[model samples]
Target: MKVTLKLPKPRNPLVAPARARKAGAHASYNPARKVRRTEKHKLNQALSGRKTEGSYDA
Candidate 1:
């Protein structure tokens, strides 16, 4: 015995985004700043299990 399956047609993609934009305000993306020394040191220590040795103050 053999069986066949049928799938429904996909809806138009353009209709969804237009409806969403009209409903609410759109969001904007902003770039992030460079990481701080303290943050970098902590991340390094967490990953390597050792404190970084260096002069942080210039």
Candidate 2:
């Protein structure tokens, strides 16, 4: 009779979500200076009930 051993799978880093994978905020060309940073602006937009496009401020 022969016995078999089971091996456990190794844990890997969790893949970041699509939103989280996005780049951080940055300064863009805004004469009105409405959106200074992309990330911060996005958050502010969400709070203000504005549509967020998740685009860089470049």
TM-score of every prediction relative to native:
0.31, 0.26
Off by over 4 Å in 1: 23-58
Per-residue lDDT of candidate 2, residues 3-36 (tens digit):
9889898755575465467676676557566544
Q: Report the number of the highest-lDDT candidate.
A: 2
lDDT of each: 0.62, 0.64
Off by over 4 Å in 2: 1-36, 52-58
| Stretch of 10 with least lDDT, candidate 1 | 25-34
Structure candidate 2, residue pairs in collision: 25-39
RMSD of each: 8.7, 12.5
